[model samples]
Target: MIRRIAATLSALALTLCLGVALWLNDWIDETEIPPLVLETGVEVLDRDGALLRAYTVENGRWRLPVSYDAVDPSFIEMLVAYEDRRFWSHPGIDLRAFARAVWQRLTSGRIVSGGSTLTMQVARLLEDSGTGAWGGKIRQIRLALALERQMTKEEILTLYFHLAPYGGNIEGIRAASLTWFGVEPRRLTAAQSALLVAIPQAPNSRRPDRFAEAAEIARNRVLSRAVTFTDLTEQDVDWARNEPIPTERRDFPALAAHLSDRALADRPTQATHFLTIDVVLQARMEHLARRATTGLGPQISAAIMVMDHQTGEILASVGSPDYTDHPRTGFVDMTQAVRSPGSTLKPLIYGLAFDAGLIHPQTLVADRPISIAGYAPQNFDEVFRGEVTAAEALQASLNIPAVNLLSALGPHRMLSAMGRADMEVSLPMDEAPGLAIALGGLGTRMDDLMRLYGGLARGGIAPPMHWRAGEAPGDGQRILSPVAAWYVADILGDVTPPPNAPRIGLAFKTGTSYGHRDAWAFGFDGRHVVGIWMGRADGASVPGAFGADLSAPLLFEAFSRIGDRPTLRPGPPPGALTLLNADLPDPLRRFDPQGGSNGPPQPSITFPPEGAVLAYQPDLPVIARVAEGTPPFTWLWNGAPIAIGDRDREVILGDIGLGFGELTVIDATGQAGTRQIEIAD
Candidate 1:
């Protein structure tokens, strides 16, 4: 009779819970889960929906997808063992456990125990619980009925995985995996799985790290059940129980935040939208960036990007080295920093000038020192070259010539181009009055600079920069005439120094900002163009850190090691214009710096000068000159040796580097009178 009464009470409690759950379900509005907000405004993903990172939102509530592959099998085993052992046997609530629970409660003469099963737990979670005991019981019973009627055993477990709270604010396995283990649910190992399963019981109050020892106890329970019910072997349980779990992969939480701030510009939530990043290429880019940044001190940083010139897709982007694990790194993202682009902006001005029909590849310009009223434009050496074709001037990286071209174009044209390129600089329009535009006198960002050059690379059409895949791109304004674009490309291709490694064929340019505050190098082969701008985001100056010295090495190294990419025929320019080498009889090298290469003929000195010092005159430093000879050779000196084009020490006065050295001649016909010497005062 007592047992019958206990059974009756349990049945009555189950019936009450079931009715409440039905009432709540019918009363409540909806149950479908909402998505996590994209506070950063731009979403970065691999080509597929796999997430790379995200930014903070006002609510700080972001939800990632709960994939079917997400739950750890061990987690399932543990939940079944501890939450409801007879979960498969029961329709929803366990009638036997409920009866026993009622008898215990009655014997204790108070509410000492309350029986609950996974299905009832699911019900309470589906909606808010009422305050009174009767109300709570009704709610639980109603939810159990809902679960039993609406879901299969498999479906119940899946929903529970999604709705079950694991830790503070982490609603599902996917979120919990990222927060604690730094990996996706699919990536967690058995040990990690065990620890996660133990967390939901007392989430916020429990510290997985602090109670790692206690987590082991629960881990064993899951392992034992898994062995008996599943095909898992005893050895597997032993390993999980005894072997320490290797740490889960960590993420650069700070980087995500930083990328969030920058990538989340006008449209704050845009960062979470599907981005145009190619996961594979982004991986490749990250590897290359990390390798390059190795050994750089903590204060140092780097940003690199791989851009598809035609499509404007950012294939791979690494703003900082892999910091997914190091706790100390809660800082900067290299990708979106607003730093000076140094010479990376060179191509923009040059391309623009060419597009405007103001310049051509074969156009002759003087690479000589000239003083602009307020600013004196000089080459790197503060020297000058007499004249050179536009291609030669750019290839040699002559500063003066660029300033001259800028001067010729004037600042209005430059400002116009800058506007078209989307540069947000506060230029007075009067400051950049000359050819110095070729040297990137104005500051620019890595993103805009890359886009500007990409325009030139992709037939002079400005391809919009995007972080998401979309239906179709709107037309971009034509920034360059097809002929103008080809002219610059052809020039860059012809003038580029041979690649350090024959394996790499690149068409690129290098640039350095004034005072060496930034170093920039960018180039493209066929399919892709990469622009790298490196410097302290704080705008620190690193002397001698010119484009060739810093950014170029990385650019070259990447292309050299990246293996073969298919060649793209830039195709013929519009109007049937084609590339043809024009000898351009114009003078390209400067004739003077006093002792410059273009200096008129000088005298010769001799072996007497080996140790003997002649009276030194301050003005006319002793100069050795030679008569023009056959076959070219180098010359050395007592006064100052000159390279007499052929095998003689003819005074090409500026040939100072060959000072006090031997003259090597290739052709015969030696003439003693060929050499002349200007004795020291």
Candidate 2:
């Protein structure tokens, strides 16, 4: 009876134990894996997938995503060899390693190793674990099994590669590689690879920048073990072991900061964005811009943009000399900031005139003092060339010639052309387009200027530039005739290079805005278009900072630094004319500003009617207008010519004598009109 009773109890206990095991198995199978929220920081990469800049996550962690291919093969072998020898063959749990750990701990009276696989570590990271020993280990084991079944080995490795901590705020091999060695993981040497593989085991202890001796010790440990599993020879292992640890972390490459910020702002939720920037070239150009700004004095900054003419890819865009420069307001992106373009827009005006058959490059133009209404435009040097060919006038950037052509072309039409070419020109509120726009009275962004120049480089077809991959190239808009574009490009190419610089053989133009507030240089080779701007963020005038003097040399330097110099001159299209002044047709020789056989209309004063008593203060503003006449009108007070400004429509007659005075206006065609007004004090 006793034997039968023991048998029954044993069976019952065995049955209960089996039932509990089955229940636990079902529970483990049904347990759902916690969702891994690897909220990586925003990363900006160059065209070649090189990191340009990275923003930390809200939690201040650098969790950049990584793929197996992005890491060195040797690093992977060393990692697996040292951490989990059975990683490839095991189904997440290595029975032999666990047994060895238990035996060694029991015999030595202390724990030697945890014996956790990479998959198990990943599972643990996915969970919020407590200090409970056996229970937590069992849970991790179960989760590891589930994960192994759900994910492939490569995926698990990728997770470990990205999630492993390397030091303070740094996670993943990619981040560590960049921070510790100033390079990508794929470019790591044997020493660098071993160092990265050993860091995650004790990240704080092995931080090369913080604990150099500890880091070296850990690196040597990995290197000693690497010879057993990796293809590295004994010599390789010895050299890597002897390699000194990095003493400092490096600054992340800060190329295209403003642009990257803009990209992030546009897609705030995205973790990564790729731009069209060539990081190598971008770095070189940024260095150049910074060096140039130092000599420009305090509070002055510079911006440059490079675009491929054929593909419309913006290869480089340096928004400022230094984005962190607080005194200079370097945070402001001048490339997108609207500022007066000065004489930079002259090339487009001449191109339009050529397309309209209004004039040719060699056409004669008068640069003498003249007025339209009361507005008078002056040259930068305050000296005018009497009779210059259209090409010469444009090459010299004479304000009078540009104003005359703008008056004939009509400001509305010129602005309309710019609009069609995907460039926006900012005008004063409630103001109509005027000839003043021809000489920097309007505002435009540097990007628009690049597009305009890029259009000229692209045989007169203007297309919007592409900044990111997969962006659709816009339809090409015909901004100028092929022949006309070629003519302008040819004229600009012949412009004298800045002193000591080679004739870049590029069609380039420079401009100085009114009050010397902005300097601009836009140039194009056969395959590229480059635009540069230098000025103060507050719009403060920097006297003597003219475009040709301050910005042109930098422009040439940038072109030379651009890798693989392109052909200097572009081939002329059909119907294009390459001729000297004497080879042009008679009608094309001298542009007829009147556009009629009859002489230009006599100038007349429309405001402050003749013989009217006008109340005026010496400092008060007064406007004088003419009913009909050609542009570049000149105003004389008592037969004396005053030094007027660059305008055609209206002139600001500053401080006319308080007594009765005679006002006379003369057009470029030599027609004159006079009026009399008495000022009441």
Candidate 3:
């Protein structure tokens, strides 16, 4: 009787356990989560859309966004080796293997040796993206069994291939392929495959820079797998080493970290994201920024942005001028750092006034040094042109005119305009002085400033700044008037550097921050608005260092590489160029209807085409119009004997000013065009 009773109780207990297990399984299967999405990358592109990057979830890790097939197989292999050794053989759950892992853990002091097969891992990745303890692990085991029953081995592997985490905020082999290998997973070679496969072991800890040995070891292990699976030897590996190692692997941590910070800003991984970036454009920007800062000094960082002016699509962002290729160095993002913008803000200030109808492109303002309640503003050089046109003030990057223009337009309005441009900086209406506003005293993100300039380039509509994946949650608002935008764009074009530059049909502005701590050059050509910001990480000053000297060349390199030329879309500006009431001061007072001072507000004899070439005699003055928001500029050639009076109008090749070499004008933030002149004196 006792034996029979015990047997019945055992059967009952078993039935109850089975019931509970089934119930939990049903619960887990039914548990639905809105897909893991990145808020910034919530924007979905069309088929073959030109998005420059992708963020995929792979095997339970968060990684960078990459191209669909961007990861190397090595990256994939790393997941297989570390997560599931019998990935090729196991159906999903290996009961015997799971038993062994349990025994090993019981005997050992570690929670190591998970016998989860590739199928189980894929299941875990799908169901468990947590950093918690036993709860996630128990769920993982149950899900693995369910997944094995639900999906074929091939299907599970396929899913695993797409969703494994390789690094920070980056998931899936696709993103790993792009972020680490800078290639597609489909195109991965055995060596490249090994590199990709190795990264996930400890994405952050086994950084290429910090743990080169470990990463290489992990790579070699994947290589060994591919080799052993076939008929290759260490000798083959020896032969392969002669081939090029991946340059991308060397830069992974930096790129991944940069994207991580950018991604976290918009939304958590659960929200939708749309990035205003094209993959090719983003890659191109990084390559160019790296090239530009190749020989620049140590501790110098730069932030670069390429935006579609109208769409506010940030096609590419390179936050670091060039990372030291060191893992720790990856911690600092040059693009996000707040630095003085100096003259880069000049164009925007002018744009603020132009947009408000408070100032005209032909507005005349005294360029001479001016004292504003003990805030004496001066030009980049100590001396200044007494009375100058707005255009000259911009081209010369004069401080006083910008301050004067800001003063005319209320400080509150100027800040408001910046806000409208998607700049995320605050100026307590009182602390943010109008007089020194042109000098770029406000602290702001480099990316923000780029978008602000993008507003001008896009013809007055300031599209909301976008990063990661999706379009702005809502359509953006127009910040500047269309006419105001056009006027600014036009003036920017007029003052653009000469025809000799490799880049053409581009509008740009350059700036220097206080104490020369930062140098910046940014602006838009027809298609892309690129902004570059350079500064010392420690906030050290660079004496005599200004944006024009340091940052313009970097802009040229990028523009030269970006093949497409953008043309201004047609639209009427605020005022006609009849030159009816344009105020021309002395030196410029003798305004040439075809030259400087005589160009704007005048329906003149001729308007040069967007990409025209000009030659000059040493003593002749040159003048042209750019976008209205752009400040007027002057050229002071020291040895060529060119002297542009403060009020001097027109670009001339002549004598050098008192303390400088051949001077060039950079409008907004972009490369300076080259103009050659035969000095007459």
Model 1, position 296: C-alpha lDDT score: 55
Candidate 2, residue 616: CA error in Å? 63
Candidate 2 has a TM-score of 0.84
The prediction achieving the highest TM-score against the true structure is 2
List the lowest-lDDT window of 10 residues for candidate 1.
584-593
Top lDDT model: 2
- Model 1 over residues 581-664: C-alpha lDDT tens digits? 243211112211222124333232443343344445454444543344333433422211233334444433342232222222
Worst 10 residues of 3 by lDDT: 667-676
CA-only RMSD, every prediction? 17.3, 12.9, 15.3
Number of clashing pairs, model 1? Answer: 50
By TM-score, rank the candidates, best first: 2, 1, 3
Tens digits of per-residue lDDT, candidate 3, 1-681, equal: 999999999999999999998897786577443243322233233113433323334343334334324444444554465456676666456777788888988889666666667665565666655533577666666666566656566566666665565656666665556556555466766665666666755667555545666767766766666565544467876665444444344223223236544564645554333444555656677777666666666556666777666556666677675445552253477777767777777777776555433345665667665565687776667887776666666777778777766764557767777776667774546664555666777778788787777777766656666664454545554566555666666666666563345546567788888889988888676667788777666678878677777777777666665656564444554332324233421222221211223333411112223334444344554453223313333222211113323222334333232221122332221112222223222
